[model samples]
Target: MGHSNVSNFVLAVTVPLPSLLFYLSFVQKCDGDRWENEYWTWVCDWGRLHPLYLVNVLFFLNVDILFWVVGLVQQNVWLIDPYWTIIPVLIAHFYSAYPAAQYDLLRSRAALLLIWIWSARLTYNYFRRELWQWGKREDWRFTDIRRKDPRNWWWKSFFVCFVSQHTFLVGITLPFYSIFTNARPWNAWDGLAFLVCLSGITIAHVADTQLHSFVARNNILKDLGAPTEPLLNRGLWHYSRHPNYFGEQLFWWGLSLFSVNLGQSWAVVGTAINSACLAYTTVLVERKMVQEPSRADVYRQYQKSTSVLIPWFNRSTLVKSKTS
Candidate 1:
């Protein structure tokens, strides 16, 4: 078969097969004790000790290996970008539907609703940014990396793209595991988490919308052979250089609160790691912005006046610094 056909076949089988098996073997049974075989029982026992192991295995097979092979075949390592908005919702539902899941119905339902909202917003933004084109372009960051080391990128991408995502994506969703495992009643903490998540979603939506409009206008300007704006400095961008990122961080941290409500504070580690990764990404993005001849000086000045990731009043531009 052709390379495209081969990759399609792999995607078709691997993506749903593990999830189907998991549902049939475990979720459908609804009782772990019913497995009579010693081997199945042993597997169940191990799964309980490492509650995330089964899901991790599913991700490894479905995403890590599947995407790596597809990337190699297609010569496009951007397969995971769109899926980033999707996988968390799947993970949340998986946990909620797990045979051993014992979460409070209200809390689980609310969490699921919030996740769906977040997913919808992000997925819409991604498609909007792509002008509704599917796989028309890869993210600039990945393109840059591939350009730097084209010879070894195929192998290196497995580690750089898939494996690193395995860490961040799985880690950030750890709270879902905690929430499903615990049967704690809905409380004030859950309310707080919901509000924070809603707020984050709103902020991210507004920031992304403004940025998208700005980019579209610039494209029009470019087409007309007119000078485009140097940078977006209005709305949320006026207060923070990356309000969308700030909003995303808030959403994850808010999700972590659900685990905290269940007294499993350790789940916050995932959100913390996600934040650290975002901070590093922010630095990279800012450096790239500064490299642009058209926008470097303007962006640098904006950086001096604006918060990096959080919304705050801009510093007074008139306040002269010692260096100045």
Candidate 2:
């Protein structure tokens, strides 16, 4: 048990350390620094970079530490939760060489690899692009926090924002770890889980494609003397203001299939956390996407018409539809 606990801590630190170092190194260039920094210059700029990024990086890194430490105490298996496919899924499942020893490490590793590739691609794309924006990019959510607080409270706002994002990211991964560690031998549950997760990923891709296409067409129209405004209704988006968010929740919920116990003490809690995290996405990420007064009603109408997380073929009150 002692050994396992230590292993958990070490595992948690893996991604966090690299991410912290990478972001910190990159952010230093935010201030009027040139694209290139000499060896010693790197260290100096890091010392002078925005404390906001530093605080967030530390908070994220510590979260990694806390998870490993908690795994030790609760006997929680690290990177084997069996609930989420975000990060741990790839590490524990696809890379497990000792299939016979670990019971099905090979299969798990394959699944993990697939999930990791998909999620890593998406997350890196989203998070890194935001960082690349430098001051031009403000995570819209941060603007609200900044406005709600006075200028003097920027530090507190920074702390809150950084902690919230870090913690939320951690929560997103919790379900997968729970599933892998607790559930043994893939059963019928695995198929269900796979379908759900795949569905989510596929639909999210579709939504993103459609959104970009819509914008591109509008850009062309604008060039032709008409602006293509923000698309609130079209394709899957017409069904729900946020099909992508729904897909995200569905994917995590599916991943949780591996770890859930219909009656385990943590079973319900894990499910609830997975569900709540999706809700948080809707409230935090989706609601703020629009600002026009005229379109608010359309958004509200679409929200009422569509299923929030579950997919449906069309707008139906009896069932949730993904394709509308």
**Model 2 agreement with the true structure over 1-324: per-residue lDDT tens digits:** 356445544564563555445445544443344556485366446544333344344445654444334433443222322113243442333113211123345336535754775576455445343332212233455445556865634345434443444455444544434444433665676667677778877777677666666766876998999755654466887666667666666666665565553122353354566577567767755465445564566666566666665556445444544443
lDDT of 1 by residue, 250-287 (tens): 99999999999899999999899989999999999999
- The C-alpha stretches of model 1 lying farther than 4 A from their native spots are 1-17, 30-32, 36-45, 317-324
- Candidate 2: list runs displaced more than 4 Å: 1-103, 124-136, 150-153, 179-183, 227-230, 261-271, 280-291, 300-305, 313-324
Error of 2 at 238 (Å): 3.2
How close is every model to the real structure, measured as TM-score? 0.90, 0.58
Best prediction by TM-score: 1
Per-residue error for 82 in candidate 1, Å, reads: 1.1
> How well does candidate 2 score on lDDT at residue 67?
39
